[model samples]
Target: MASKIAEAELDSVEKVFAAQEAVPSWKDQLTFRSFVIGFLLTILITFIKVKVSLNTEIIPSLNVCAGLLGYFCLKVWTQCSSQLPFTRQENSVIQTCVVAGSGIAFSGN
Candidate 1:
């Protein structure tokens, strides 16, 4: 019945939430590795933005680029090491730095 299905879905959702809460979250500390990677990514993205700006009037999407780069880096890191990979907060921090750096580069042009 539709009611049974709804109840089942609700139970499943509750179970998932319980499981998530039981798992300890990663420490919120900013590691040196994250800082260095974010800085380097910002520089690299800014350089690419400037180069593209020089060649064409169309501006590149730094937000998307930053997100993709962050995701890729985290994925690679997760694969290469047994340690916990960067979290969403870390990715957001990296993207913010990239956007700010790229904005400066654009303004200087």
Candidate 2:
């Protein structure tokens, strides 16, 4: 049964590839989008760190944790937007953390 399912999936994949190949000059390049997204993320992280650092009311541990959380958030956003190539499972891992952390961070704010 598994083998049959796998075969069916392979057939669909073959059709998809064939269709893609038939397209004329689709660029298929993500370099510019990737650069822009990365730049935006860097700016955001820097801004957040600078702003948060001004108020030392937050514990040092908390700041570190938040910074790490921001990093993960950036990664998740980039991946979800197809910034970098990843398998479905890899994307899911980052996406799950992104959503949970975003919820916590926003509510805390």
Candidate 3:
């Protein structure tokens, strides 16, 4: 049943969170690099959203687009620099910032 599936998902989420807390990464999640990347991505995504809105009136989903782009960009950056740590927390922060920035741009119109 759907209820059983939902309960299983909830249980899995709980276990994941518990495990995360048990093994702390202890890495800096809010680094300057994350902010810089997030700022650039926000500007880029905002511009694209504005242009798309003007042309097709169909705004793209910032969460999916920004998350994927941010992840890819960070991965590439890490591979190149080899100094920056690619932590999930940092990626989530950057993605959230970019998405929020794009949302603000959309609402301002």
Candidate 4:
């Protein structure tokens, strides 16, 4: 059974490795704007989650809220500044960060 599982893993790895392309550097994605936006969203989302949970039994989906809000805010930010173009990848990272940070904050309460 172990051998069979190893063979399956090896097959999957080989298939994925063959299709892989040169990954873009994450350093470029780690911008000051991303951190600032992520941190602010984290605080905002955490507060919303805590308040909602306190008033009602329903907890809002963090990912959905974060993604929507992050994209909208980033779009507005882009319009205000012509220097940086907001990419889907950056938005995703910010959303993930906000969700994670918010979860931690909410749980801490």
The digit string of per-residue lDDT tens for model 4 on 1-109 reads: 9999999999998897676454546986677787789999999999999999999978787798899988988889989998678766788889989989998888788
Per residue, candidate 1 scores C-alpha lDDT tens digits across 1-109 of 9999999999998886774444344556355556666778888988888888778967787798887887788778778988876666677767777788778877887
Which stretches of candidate 4 lie above 4 Å from their native place? 1-23
Model 1 TM-score (2 dp)? 0.68
The positional error of residue 7 in candidate 2, measured at the CA in angstroms, is 0.9
- For model 2, what is the C-alpha lDDT against the true structure? 0.47
Name every residue pair that clashes in candidate 1: none
What's the alpha carbon RMSD for model 3?
A: 4.2
Q: Could you tally the backbone clashes for each prediction?
A: 0, 0, 0, 0
Candidate of highest lDDT: 4
lDDT at 60, model 2: 22
Question: Per-residue lDDT of 1-109 in model 3, one digit per residue for the tens?
Answer: 9999999999998887775554345456777778888999999999998998899989878688888888898888998997856778778889989999889977898
lDDT of each: 0.75, 0.47, 0.84, 0.85
Native-to-model Cα distance after best TM-score fit, residue 27 in candidate 3, in Å: 7.9
In candidate 3, what residue range of length 10 has the lowest lDDT sum?
A: 19-28
Pairs of colliding residues, candidate 3: none
Instruction: Tell me the TM-score of each prediction against the true structure.
Output: 0.68, 0.32, 0.72, 0.74
